[model samples]
Target chain A: MTTGAKRPKRQTAKRTPPKAPPPWDPSIVVFACNWCSYAGADTAGVSRIQHQPHFRMIRVMCSGRIQPGFVLRAFEKGADGVLVSGCHFGDCHYIFGNERAVEQFEKTKEVVKLLGLEEGRLRLEWISAAEGVRFAQVINEFTDQVRTLGPSPWNGKRQQSVGRAAGQRPTTES
Target chain B: MPELAEAAKKTKAWACYDCGKCTATCPIARVGGSYSPRRHVLATNLGQQREIVENNTLFTCLTCSLCDRRCPAQVTYTELVRDLRELSHGHGVEPECPHGGALQSVMRMMAKGGTQQNRMGWLSQDLKTESAKGQVFYWTGCTMYYDAFFPEFQVKTLEGTRSAVRLMNKLGINPVVSPDERCCGHDLLWNGDRKSFELLAEHNVKLVANSGAELLVTSCAECLRTWKVDYEPFFGAKPPRIVHVTEYLAEHLPDLKFDTDRAAGTGPDGDGSRGPVRVTYQDPCRLGRHLGIYFAPRQLLEALPGVELSEMRRSEAAAICCAGGTWSNCDRFAKQIQVERLREARATGAQVLVTACPKCQVHFRCAMKDPNLGGEIEIEMRDVVELVDQAVGQK
Candidate 1:
């Protein structure tokens, strides 16, 4: 049975006081809606399933609330990875809410690259409240992907990295 | 490949297990208590064609992404719903919405310039067949051009779109425009006018081919959805590069200097004294759900500096439809769904409701006036372009 405690440090090194790691362990923020994805996480807890400890979740009423700018803001605030979880199509507590997330994911993928982030760093998934195992699997997979991508360019080298290469603006690469 | 598109293309109707989650969650599904996606999909798969098409449930769909966002199989339920509506229309089944008069009026206005076609008129002044002399053409859909109720919005749309064109021009790319541009079969396709849709598609595709313009840019979400998704298959040729105006604008906003003041939340009195307003945004189904255009509008809104953009309880993929989606044309049913949408928007505590689609703006505005919705909320609706227009001194 999984305990509700934070996972033991794995491949993470503590840095000097007052400063984040130079090659920081990636931070991920997941915005999960209450109806499906959030409940899925809740089910994971109830089921005693274990997942990665790389993410901090914020519960939203629906996946439709996830704006691409919020993902960009998370990235700007040093989030190396972001996950948006919603109900599968036709399962939203609000009709069409998950579909909006599906559409937004397309543009968000482009925007992430436009900001120079790696592909798959940000993900949109449809995880029902009953799918505890799926939720655990998605979190673990996303955590590993972010680990490979490393810290976002915006987070490291605060002084020298001002703009442009810092992934602030849209680029032709998207 | 986006999963929504892939799923929509692949999934068969019987895949749905009839969880009733989609109907229960739908903003419009509760209207008259007669709408249900699970039932509709089940019926369609069972070949209960006559019954499914005749039912008012199909029209109750706001075409919102809520069901799409929640489906476990990613069944693309909404597309199936749209197909049902088309079938119903094919059988000469008429929805209860007053869409007929509105669409006819809107189409007539598009043929002749009027207040409705303000944005298109603005385009006529700045762009022309001569300007769009290259191998590109702009499909000025009816919503952007002939929607008179949204004058301020139309102007802002032109300004932002023009800014993008200017940037492209500076980049040594001169995309052409045709003053003779007509609707891209968005309304016809959505409303089940398949024959008209085909004619317009053929006509527009031929026009673009003859003009030698390989690119097409439009500010309308519906146009982008139809042109890219529906028409491309029919043409059997590489479709033009159809882009939403916001996508084009975000690419160039940093280079353009514009002064915009934030209008967060204000009371019914339009007073700023109510402490910084807690503002939220609603994603139009086409722009947010169909096209994945959640960021561009948010970037435009967030760029205003002090505006605290709190998200709606249901946003992006999970957003409730404004109830004015293409299928909402069936009168009493559409209004019923609109009422539900108003309640959801009111729940956001956002004094000002912002969206990109003119249809959403109109529905939200009308819904706010319903006496049944508990005496009104001091909410104002505006397009994203209107806000940008105010910022750039074009207002």
Candidate 2:
């Protein structure tokens, strides 16, 4: 169940230095809870569900542990889209952790929109430990949405804007 | 006024020697109102119930406690005014409320039980918030509704709420902030509706108390005042600790810094520049003299490198009330007072006027809407939390 592994380079005509540095492909960050969505990704592989290879997953004990900062950091580090999938409500191993996840996810979604990030770049879903097909479908759908957004403005120095730079480096006293 | 004359004597409202010092220091008196504190006291003490009640002068008082500071007789003029207002209500004589009393009506409606509110609609997408579970609870107190009601003011009143969450997030505390918060009952209680006030108070106290947060923070001055002062009597016993956003940020100022990269130098208007933006402060009466908090906001403002704390002439304890708030007592005198305060702020050469209350921005912006005015407001008005949020690189 690993994703976003480096693939074999495609043959291309020799190009000048001014050409694009790499192939254009979507990059998505997936936040999966230890008890549910993380294991679901494993189930996706065991069942061999065909899905996009754009996801890079990070596992936490509970989806409720994710903060807006983590999402902002992912975007700041060049994530074109983010997928937050936790256990279905009421089925959370932690009892109410998925509920908290849902609320916090809704909260961060609005903050993302205010920061000028497209609504399609961030998502929240409930994919239980057994929902491998659902997990794969979620990744594929998110990849298509992010594909239309092209590269995140946070991709590299070439994409940096004054606002994004200032946003990333909020000043604090020495 | 007659029924309160006896209670007034107990509070020493009968001791006015007609020295007129209260009149001289009164903002309303200076505005040529017949409702001067000196005159009101003299009339009420002399048993001029018919005249005082007929003229409906009791509502004009801001209850700011300015005259009490200089009253040689220590007459407790503000307390007397409150008593008189209660009596006037008992007599079924009430002062007129602006906006056709729509805001007051909403407060009255909230006082009743079983009203549902979509208070959380103002929550921005990325702002982190907690349910009734975190250690710190932020009381937004009717600001969300006000922003919608007074959109003509063009002020993002709820941005203060949003920034408050962001600021708290930066402080490393996930605040237990709920949009389900009821009005703190400031206007209802001050306007002499004890029954309604208690109803609203009971609802709010239960909500916050259930949140398990020992500390409560609010950006609204009236809410802070109600929590700091009024919550004790209605709810009984000391309630959760309540801190204004200014106080909270000031205490954490050492841990915060201004955004050096965002300081693009003061461009024209709130240009997201860091050019040492000169800001004058409007002391909302409830936060200042009403609650005795005049220093925290200044400390927070001074902590920003590009922010210069400019002082207005009527600042601190002597500051003029925004005039439009409190029981929705909006009137011509309140409008005049607001415009005059804006003039004082502009006179200080500050690019912005900072306040800890949302309605102050609403009142000033409403007054500036007058097309007949010589010019539009030259200075911008902002809430202290908005300033703090920007200093920490929040929108």
Candidate 3:
């Protein structure tokens, strides 16, 4: 049987191996407010709550500090999804920081949508510091949602091809 | 430093003979800022690269090209500022962009490519647009972004773009409006981000080329100048002929039908019922001084029945800038320039301050928000296309 299998090696060489695309995992960026959502993420960690491990947390002083630029920069740098988590309304440490975050998030949402990203890819949620299980739930939910949407158009292969296409174009003048 | 000398030689900054005309003509200098085109030229000529970069006047220039008009030696002052800015940007010196650089970040993100944009959300059911191939391609620029970013301004930048398309539709032409059309990179190039600008330009050039369009029409003055002047040299063979929307519409003046009666009675302040609706033209520096599109907009405005075109004191080549350009250095100086320009517009005795540039509309409206000004400079602002669309009776 081993000799028979070896006899087909010449036939195998004539056929190309099937190219299996690498299994894709969502790359999510979570912008957490230091006073609330960041602490919530910490609590989830300390509680050993099992959440999706795909997200990277960036702690900002206040939710208001997350400008549209911050979220845009994340997408520009090829983030699959971005979650801007903040303190609940009226529960903000600085009185109205979360309110301002709502305003900024609306603007960011418009830009993100206009840029043709999936509506679910960008989200704003109010997570309290004590809500460890809730943080884990949000994380797992967001990661699963992003996974269903597949890799962002800005991700690896598409980006490389775009660069290659631009490079291939004729440059008639300097 | 050698790049600075090269820039100087290329722009003919060496031809400057210490003449104060450029300084006198500079809007920033007029507003009492230390920004002088002549001073920068002298510094570049003397090879004082460090002084020029550290002084940071390079970003302060509005690059309106007004100084180019005043220069007897024909020195291209605006190009010098642009090249110097490109150098400064390479050295990691970033401009103090307004709105905390949110707008700039949006533009930079677009430059990255491969981000599919839903730019056609503004295209309504009535407006006919072809996506794949057409003779005319309408480049929307960043109107949708601006509309979302500055909702408080109530300028409705996208509305002007929509009006442009509607006008084209009325002329029995279905323009190709690409959803993948990116920013013209006018702001990025002027802000000294050459690499990002090139990326956007390449994407746009390829998009238009693939669309098989022979004529590319844009409503934005900055985008028009960018496509016509900056992007032309870098484009591959057989680039489409770029024209401003007003310029294109002006050519087909005979074909356009306007409802003069409706336009006369539809003034915001109810003053149009008395006589022809008086509108003063605010020459966007890009359209006027840069592209020399002085008559096209005026020609279109005059063609609209019941719409009287009032020229401001500083109209045409002498027009003041919208104060803000390239989204950089929008400081008290910019506000002052805006306030003064608004006051001039108010003095023209025209109820409507009509401008062809969306930035001019945005800047002037922003200046009007000054609580202290208190209705003194509160003239109604409208884009030329919006008025034309109204006069044509949007079906």
Counted clashes in each candidate structure: 43, 10, 0
Worst 10 residues of 1 chain A by lDDT: A165-174
Candidate 2 per-residue C-alpha lDDT over A1-174 given as tens digits, one digit per residue, 9 for 90 to 100: 478778766544344344434444567899999998999999988888887786789999999887655675677566788988889888889999987777667756654543445788999988988999888888877887777666666565334332221111112211
Off by over 4 Å in 2: A1-174, B1-6, B46-48, B236-238, B264-274, B374-376
Candidate with the larger DockQ of 2 and 3: 3
Model 1 lDDT tens row, A1-174: 576888787445445345432333457899999888888998988887877666789998989877655675576556778898898889888999888777666656654443335677888888998999999888878877776655555554333332222212111110
**Could you say which candidate leads in lDDT?**
3
Write down the lDDT of every candidate, Cα atoms only: 0.63, 0.76, 0.86
Which regions of candidate 3 deviate over 4 angstroms?
A1-25, A155-174, B268-273
Q: Candidate 3's residue-wise lDDT over B105-145, tens digit each?
A: 77887887666888888999999999879999998888888
In model 1, where do residues sit more than 4 Å from their true spots?
A1-174, B1-11, B99-131, B135-137, B144-146, B149-175, B235-238, B260-279, B327-333, B343-351, B371-375
Q: Compare candidates 1 and 2 on lDDT and give the better one.
A: 2
Judged by DockQ cut-offs, is candidate 2 incorrect, acceptable, medium or high?
A: incorrect
What fraction of the true interface does each of the listed models get right, in terms of native contacts kept?
A: 0.00, 0.00, 0.61
Q: How high is each candidate's interface RMSD, in Å?
A: 18.2, 18.0, 1.6
What is the model-wide C-alpha lDDT for candidate 2? 0.76
Give the CAPRI rating of model 3. acceptable
Please identify which of the two predictions, 2 or 3, would achieve the higher lDDT against the true structure.
3
- Candidate number with greatest DockQ: 3
